[model samples]
Target: MGDFIDVEQLYDLAMTYSVKLLQALLLLIIGLIIIKRLTSFLRKRFERRKLDPSVRSFLLPGISLSLKILLGISIATMLGAEMTSFVAIIGSIGFAVGLALQGSLANFAGGLLILVLKPYKVGDYIETKDHSGTVNEIQIFYTTLDTPDNKRVIIPNKELSNSSLINYSINKTRRVDFKFGISYDDDIKLVKDILNNIVSSHSLIIQEPEPKIVIGEHGDNAIIFYVRVWCKREDYWTIFYELQERVKLDFDQNNINIPYPQMDVHVSNS
Candidate 1:
């Protein structure tokens, strides 16, 4: 009789827990769907505010993770866990774990600061003392970069946030500067005209700023002509290299002498 009673009680307990488990499963699915919609809505709102892309990339995942944690706690509470005690236990455990993983926590903090300050974003070409690359991703602990040579680099958030960085792609337009030195005997007006023609011929160079070509300084062996031209950021290198090559070829054709450093030293025994 006792064995039969035990079996009956076991069945009762199983049925009772099974119902709660099914309800929890349904709640979990519905909660996830709601979270997805909520996150999407928040993303649109963030975009409307014109928040930085890096900030958006960093914040959305954090918010979703937090919401999901809360959802989990709610489900646990519904399964007969004490809400207040459960939260307290979680809080205490998080505190302990945070203390244990202080370095990781610092990296997380640095990542937050980076997102908030808007130093650089994904697709921005940035350079540091050791690394130079286009930013590929920003994660909680590290930032990934794709170098010009097609190498991938992973930098810790702590090091990146603390270091000085140059963001080359921040501005819409970039200035390409060139200093060309010609022999003192070369005709200045002719050289300037050739440079102007070169600038005008190029489709990539912008016309609004007006290409600057003028006598900059007189070097020991040559007269330095400074050239400054503005172009779209992506076209900067193309314009720079092409102009240099064109000027060299044009100068050779016109017999406009490009002077090299020469020192005339007379050594005599007095």
Candidate 2:
């Protein structure tokens, strides 16, 4: 050995390691704070400008996460680690992770499609093969739904996108279709007049379509009529239920017979 260990060299080594550790810690903390602030700022700016909630909710988290990841790698490089191999190492590890999380990646892709295509939005009453409910939240991996009976449903985004979605609440107005059957003996014109009056006088019905009540079909037992009315979306269910009740009451009061199928049987005696 050329010489014994010196206190000065040990002191310098300790000082160097301390400085590196401190720098790494400081850079990490600062980078995280900056990422947080930037994301918060972006979200507020979008919200203040009245941007769509879906856009804001999706973009902010993504931008923040990406920035933090990049900043962390930069800090790691500054702490005396060779970033060339580090980058390749991280890339390979990320590739393996991506393979492991294939389903999650697919869900994320589905979420992007949902956001872009806008098949449905929060609070929209949607029906799909997987489930039917009012959408409460649209997240990266899943979409949350609340059913009519107050049940919470969480469906994977991939499944939702793969199926047909019926978004009932997307528009401001909706048409309500109702069918009624009357005895063939009943006057068609009289039935039409009663139905028109009942539909037009309803509080929720819109007058623009003019409340159509038309003869639909002639069945064995009864003549069918179709009643269609347009109303605001919020009033759909209420108007639907009220119309059924009101129409029945009106038909009963006017002695209009609603016929049902009946058969007379004769037994042959031999």
Candidate 3:
């Protein structure tokens, strides 16, 4: 009779524990479901804001991980596990990982700053001390570039953030300056007229600013003419090359001489 009474008590104990276990499982499932829904909602919200791709990519994963971690702690608490040790273990692990990946963490922070500050964006042509190219992609740790020679460059986010860079595509228009040297005997007024005609006839040049032609300097063998013009960024290179070719051809046809550097030396017996 005593053994039967002990068995009944053992059965009641197992039942009570089984109920707690089931409750814990149910809470875990519900928490996971909520986390998934919330993460999805936040992702859609980010899309609605039209956030930068790099920023969105970085934020979504972080948000999801944070939410999942909170859910895990909640499930652990539901199971009546001691919170103190769990928290300590998590803290220790985080500290160790942080120490091991200090450089990576700095890069991640720099990337976040880049996305928020808007120094340059994809498709912009940028020049830094190390590289110059069009920005192809912006990742969490690195920024990719496509060079003019058809090479790919990967620059660390930390380095990029720490240095100065020039973004050429930020402005819609750019000024193109050219210096041309002609023989001192060449007529300045005639040369100016020819240059004005050349600039005015170019389809790519912006007329609003008005192309400038000025006598810049007198060199030892030649007179330098400075030409300044404005054009759309995309047309800059085309106009640059075409203008040089046209000026050379025009000078040849107009009997203008572009002099070369020459030195006159005299020696007397001492």
Model 2 Cα lDDT, one tens digit per residue, 184-265: 8888888888998887678889999777888888887889999889999999999889989998999999999999878899
Full-model lDDT, candidate 3:
0.89
Candidate 3 residue lDDT tens string, 45-150: 9789887666666677677788888888877877777799889988999999999999888888888888888788878899999899998877777888999998
Worst 10 residues of 3 by lDDT: 52-61
lDDT of 1 by residue, 24-89 (tens): 999999999999999999999999999767777778888999999999998998798998899899
Model 3 TM-score is: 0.72
Name the Cα RMSD for model 2. 3.2
> Order of candidates by TM-score, top first?
2, 1, 3
Query: After best superposition, candidate 2 residue 46: deviation in angstroms?
Result: 1.1
Ranking by lDDT: 1, 3, 2
The TM-score values for the models, in the order shown, are 0.76, 0.83, 0.72
Candidate 1 — which residues are off by over 4 angstroms?
Answer: 44-51, 136-139, 144-154, 181-193, 200-225, 257-270
Candidate 1: pairs in clash: none
Highest lDDT scorer? 1
Report every candidate's CA lDDT.
0.92, 0.87, 0.89
After superposition, candidate 3 runs with Cα above 4 Å error: 1-51, 54-87, 262-270
TM-score of 1: 0.76
The backbone clash count of each candidate, in order, is 0, 0, 0
